[model samples]
Target chain A: MQRPLDVLGSSTDKRIIIKTKSGDSIFGILKAFDSHINIWLDEASIDGEKEVKLGKVLIRGDSIVYISPEK
Target chain B: MQRPLDVLGSSTDKRIIIKTKSGDSIFGILKAFDSHINIWLDEASIDGEKEVKLGKVLIRGDSIVYISPEK
Candidate 1:
């Protein structure tokens, strides 16, 4: 079985949703991440629909709830 | 052998640490929970030291990172 990080890494360039404790999620192309799980997203949206104008965004690892790949 | 919820239920009255998405944790006596995994803790503390006067507290399931039994 692939490790969790490996699975997360596989989602790179794929549209994924990064859920946070706030009950909200960021949907974007997974760009980069580190051991801490902090992420960088390109052309991200809030909840996969509401587009955020920001070209790229950085999310703190500690604030992460979970990361799910969009089908 | 016990399931996750069962194991959590067994931790009732025992001091446990409920880690959250923020990388912070709630330490307290596990008192109650539901199928959703939302939890209630008694005499809870933040990070197991700084006491929060609140006697009981509720934690949203989605915000949970993990729970650990404290020795």
Candidate 2:
């Protein structure tokens, strides 16, 4: 069995797509999760410059629009 | 055992407060979480009104601002 913390911690090197209520989408890799459920998102870019750290965001489970596996 | 999906699903009746990267705060009950990680937030109010559905939002782990337990 897996836990919510495990799911939050399991997003390493995995390409995740997040859709916002404002109708926005963000694609990146899950870096870390804290007690607040704050997420560290590393955006995917083609420039290969570096991981664009999206900082931290408070996300309620119900506010989630969709989550899917990346190609 | 717990999973991320479980975490996403476990927010029922929980008073969750979300902080956005834009320096915005939203408080509500977690209604649901879909495959896209989109969360449906039910905002809290004192007017005795119904829950304000915030629809869905995409939140990267890193973009999290903060989340704390309500008093």
DockQ for all models, in order? 0.06, 0.07
Compute the lDDT of residue B64 as modeled in candidate 2.
39
Candidate 2: stretches off by over 4 Å: A1-71, B45-71
Error of 2 at B28 (Å): 0.7
- Write one digit per residue (lDDT tens) for candidate 2, span B1-71: 33334444445667655545454555767666455454455554321234444544444433333333233
Each prediction's RMSD over C-alphas, in Å, is 12.0, 11.8
True contacts kept of 2: 0.07
* Candidate 2: residue A34 Cα off by (Å): 14
Candidate 1 regions off by >4 Å? A48-51, B1-71
lDDT for B5 in candidate 1 is: 79
Candidate 2 docking class: incorrect
